[model samples]
Target: MAIGYQSLFNDNDSVDKANTHKIYDVIIVGSGVSGSFMAKELVDAGLDVLLLEAGEFFSRTNFPKKEIDANSKLYWSGGIEFNKSADLAFLRPKVVGGGSIVNQALLDRFDDMALDSFKEQSGVSFFTKESMQPWYEKAESEIHQEVIPKEHRNKNAEIFAKGFEENNYLYDSLTRAQKNCAYEEGNDCIECLSGCRRDSKQSTLITTLKSAINNGLHMKSLFEVKNIVHKTDEVRVDGIHLKREYESFRAKKLVLASGAMGNSKLLLNSGFKKSLPALGQNFYSHPQFMVLGLFKEQINSGNGPFQALKSADPNFRRKGFKLENVFAPPVGISMLLPGHGEEHQQLMKKISHMACIEVAIRDTNPGSIKTNRHGKMIIDKKLNEEDKKRKNAGIEAINNIFSSQGAQRIIEGNLPIGLHLMGGLGIGERARFSVVTPDFHLHGYKNIFAADSSIFPNAPGINPSLTIMALTKMAASKVFR
Candidate 1:
């Protein structure tokens, strides 16, 4: 009950949304990568900013040490949400930092192909690689990014590299938003994937949010925003405290960076369905599943950098998928392996001798997110025939790599889990399905904007945190300019 508040410095009530009297110049919904960056930029530019988060605020000092506790406290539905068909699970963060807090910290720029696709879909020239390059650099400069050196790779990563090299498959070290760590000596980077007890991961919670708070940004966590009434002059945000009591705030400008699902749900709940018919349409989540190889020797896959190597092959990109060396903790990985009872326990016992690879599909078949009358979010995502083919191809490639390394057996994850959630209030030319214009403005509303992955026209087959930040920078510049 007392979990979702930020007691920064001596002002314990500073994060209380009701404590403020004057209308803020800008109210940022969600404190993830996009909102955090936007909040920092606006506050530094002498604008009064208020950030409202539905989840609790947590620091590295008080973050959950165990993965189970982390899942329950920091993630939505304990990080085990599923689709309508119950075949896929989606991992969404419910904490202040959002996805940045729970993600693997892979920081990659959008390639030319992805940029060109965005331009073609949204008809926005600024979406091109040439124009967005400086914004990407600006986003990267705000966070610490380093390539995982060969010396820092664990045996699991080494095995992946060995197979890729022997098989002549294109692969390279991944660039992650991480500080120097002792992962090579087996420091266990699994904690970073959960809640990051080490503080080595460069999430916006510790970087942009900290800087914004220092520059007079008021952030209230545990406040679920349910409605946003677009008025002639100001936007009224109606939210309820964790206690289920009603509270409201007014802002001259409202920025919706509450993620793809969150933004869609809010707009639908706010009675804007008629004006914004595309509120929950064009949703995408890069569907991902893992393939594990059973090796004779103990690889201790859980003891080091979880994702150190990634396939750089152009063929896979052409096929609309990508592969990366990835692993998870006991609870996370166990869900991927099939079977139960003695059979499942036996595989769990051999987890230390397993090497893992993840296949993330850039799904062409877009999905939809709808909310029932009772306000429950319904996610509908299914793999089309093309997606199935690409997934099969990725699995075969993983099998080839593991077999080249002399794997005794290969295990494929049957159920897909989506870590990257994008689109909902997509930007495009003004029409029936365009929630936002090319300027990132809500179609019918003047002072409302979207800066998160919710506005992505399509999914880019890479980690989207950096791109989200870059998009935030571009959106914020439009505001200040």
Candidate 2:
């Protein structure tokens, strides 16, 4: 199916709202972390910026404090977790702030190992911990990064750490992006599954998007960009053709930050995929597995950011870089409790004290995406032998960590949620092999650029948001000039 189907969702009823007067210098697709930062940076540099978001406007009030939005107004089928298969569930958030709004807000920096590993793969040489260190500090500072002391840690977490150290494993205080912190005793992260409140999460909603809006960056939520209209070899990205919005509009330059899935669909639909064959190839979804520990004491694992601590042993290596990690949430506590009767009831009562740790692995798995016969973007991801092996190793390491930490009993969680989606448009030397260059510009299209995770040379076995930010900033710095 043609990726241009986004046109079907456009809203053109308000022809009167069309801006016949001014032309924006740049049009940014998706208002997530990168898009918001990109728009703000462009506008701050005196460029007319327009940012578009496919989801609705998520304000402080409209958003729910519920554990999951499954029953909230923003609850959409696609927004909630869904697996291509009925027995599985894939986690992805659809809203104004993008994944940043729904994520655990683990604002970690680019470790040296991750940067180096990515460089050797597609010859993407510019990404470096030193180069991105400044951005990291800035990002972390903005997010209010803090290291949770042993004092604030909940009883369960503190005990878990001790068990690890007693077993000769070094586990330090886990840092997190939060305002009111307390995980020492395994204090539960109250709103993690939903989204952090108290504005302490430091998500893009409070940082990039907030700043962009404050700087006159025009934002249009619920606007999905469907096509890129080219006239006279000049690129004209029409605002997505929606069922209820603007019919068509123009922009000088287009920046796509709609994320791996969304950007891949838009590019393939716009016919850019024809020129660059690797448009949606080399897809990497960091296979993640969680190990939950059910304790007899009241842990209250449900309280804080879904994840506040992480394990960093068996460093992930590709070329010469070491992978970094934080903590996982207490998700499996429900199932791991002792029994089906009174035992289960008592465990549920003490669920607050339960905690979990995850081993998230960035694999070499290569997956492909295809537009379904119906024209909707369908992701067909398959894990090969290599991916399976890597996943197993990651699982082993995670299980070991949990055991060392004195987890009473452990069981692998349900389908591993693939959070880090990447590689539809990678940065390689060849156009046929790579859709975009290390610079994130389309191989043949000079005016069109993709600044999302689609440009990842390969998966770096860690959170992609920070890397996404660095790459987007790098692209905007060179392309916008």
Candidate 3:
């Protein structure tokens, strides 16, 4: 009977209206970092929690060691997809761990200046540092957060660090959530994209999910929630319509954490609110580009951790948020190379000594995420004008860093890709401007909640995982009560 909620996705006839109608406390959509954190919080608060994930549960070992396989299989849009233009490729994860499994594990505290801007425009007072600082601190503690020690860094990082010194820019080793450390200096590169094998990268799969399961939380993976069913008013959440192969399951109280684009399309298809509009807007891609460095010496680039060093200019928000950091998995750099044949082979020769740094631009351009009639998600976005201006600036920043680090024959290229796509079902003031409220509750739908990047009113222009954890922790505290 404990598996009843999970069995909903396994059998179509199990939870039919005539067979049985059992209502539970919470049905949280998504098993990503935020949802996992919420599941733990709610279960610890003494509530029966059902976590619905659109993807399969993947263990760390389940990931492939090769970067290409990791990208094609674990990534959201199959490692590459176009965002408004074919020249750009957007990378999103399809696994339950979300981007945590593949991301460079760059943890950053959002600038108060950016949060203040959101508060000023959206009238959402929760965007202040003083209000959210304790929550961030608490989340960080729960995640066992710490900056990567210098000893764990590779030669490429030291080189990049020198660039910061030369330019008078502040550089700090980025924070990562790994357990016991077992990283080597330069060949640990193959592990970054495939998910950490050393129990080192403490992605959400090992962190909060472990806590939730220990607390008796039920996780339903490979089950996609199709529609929300409402049984009159008074709002007990009633139940959900979900799919597992050919069958469907139902639940009471639905939580939509299906990323920004996924949630917006689902809400519209469910007919939650048709004329209300603005269901999927205010979206940001955090468009990313890479600059590769091939040094004169055989400085191994593939070893150690991913992105041990990072530098960001807080003032970049006006131009655009520019984060510069070295990347791992020597082969991962090949995808970003712009030329073919001889030119590509030349870069490949020194690949062993190669390192890369990426810049994820936070832009304000509005985009739309909708589902086609064929049940496929579709996203259309215009490159943010300001993002275009920052592209070169971002490349220049990374290039300068590499130069300072003694990199030679540096190559630069932008991929048609982005990560941490957000704000499809954005939370705002009135029904006219936004679909969801600041609390992540939809404007007209009660008990329906969103706990993912979809609720982001503005791109924080920083790596969003920890920020998502902090916000969802706050959301659980406010909504689940």
Candidate 4:
């Protein structure tokens, strides 16, 4: 089971015209984490489900290890998309598995504090810890998560953990959604971000989507959905296929799981802008920046699990940011390396000895996602004064951590980048102020639901994949109930 892009389904490559005329029980847009799980749930309930993905499907065997090739094939905007402010850049997935396809696979469950903020902002009681615990368990089971063992810690993780232990900062082994890769047998996790060449990471591609496909799910890859309209009985979705031809789909129920930006852009282009006033509002990216530690000893950060260590202190989390061990491939690491010309080359030479960590800021300030006249997405986000102070605080914390580790020098990332994109079609009290109702139903539209991070009321600073999966599972259950 290599982490290639092989289509395991019978009709994964093209649209199945056999059922194009028949109204599907449910049409789920975006075959990523939420859509994949929702499709599984619906199909398991005996509902006919059709899953649409905007990206081309590649086989696992074709998963590229090169950063350039991977970014071109797996990421949106060729991995260089940014917000209107230009201060924040985003790396988002455009593949079938979405962020799960290229993320570090960290699988932390949302803490009570994070959920408390959501409940407070949205007045949604089900956000309570007790209420969502079962959903988390179910998602954990589906993804096959486990804490990275001590022996599997690479030199990069060792240096990161040493920094925490020496500074008396509580740190713990990270639990990730991954399968055993037998690292001792020469298998490495460096390629996980590029699609896990060993097939060890439990992305939706190998977990939920694969299971759904096996259970008779209909997936139409390379089908970019443009607009969706709610009519008298069923919903209509129009889009272009891979062949540059128009395609239309109809369903009794529709789910928008095409991420925060994707979902908002679609709704805006479909002429539902006024009806869903909050469609592209309330966007947050959990502003993140990296700190690299230059060690005298070879850390070989690129050879081991990309993110195997994380801060365990509740106080640190309360301060609006968390530190997690991180590593990047050659090309990515080179770009993050400071200096230019020969100076940059000198740092690139030390790539093997560099250990990195990212400080993910929990942004409370809201942003908006808009579409230009041509229908291209235009994300506008800014760090408020409070967010600025927090950014400085998080950076100082990272410096302290590296100082404790006896690093020769520290390099702060020149660019502030975020991978977690949330909000936009938030679930809350007001229809004019929020895009979806508390139950994830899009306002003014019957049987249309948003089952992704787009509906998140606020930013959850931690890795959001696990939380998204749990929330979608709960939403799917409610849909059928």
For residues 153-250, write the lDDT of model 2, one tens digit per residue: 55555555655555454454556666654444443555543554345666677777666666666666667677776544345555543446554556
lDDT, residue 272, model 2: 67
How well is each residue in 94-177 modelled by candidate 4, as lDDT tens digits? 887878778888888888888998888887788888998999988888877778888878887887788788777899989888
Candidate 4 Cα errors over 4 Å, as ranges: 1-18
Q: Write the per-residue lDDT of candidate 1 for residues 1-481, one digit (tens) a residue.
A: 2342343233434455444457888889998889899988898889888899988888776788788888888887766788899988888888888888888889889999898898888877787888999999888889998898777687789888998888888998899888866665557777887667667888887788878877778888889899998889888898987858788899899999899989998998888888888888888899997999999999987776767899999998999889998888888888888998999999999999999999999888888989899888998888999989989989988999999999999999767888899998988886586788888788878799998999987787778889999989888976655
Candidate order, lDDT descending: 1, 4, 3, 2
Winning candidate number (lDDT): 1
TM-score (C-alpha, index-matched) for candidate 3: 0.88
User: In candidate 1, which residue pairs clash?
Assistant: none
| Strongest candidate by TM-score | 1
Return the lDDT, model 4, position 92: 78
Q: Which ten residues in a row are the worst by lDDT in model 2?
A: 1-10
- Winner on lDDT between 2 and 4 is 4
- Which window of ten consecutive residues has the lowest lDDT sum in model 4? 1-10
Which runs of model 1 end up more than 4 angstroms from their true locations? 1-13, 17-20, 184-186
Each candidate: what lDDT? Answer: 0.84, 0.61, 0.68, 0.82
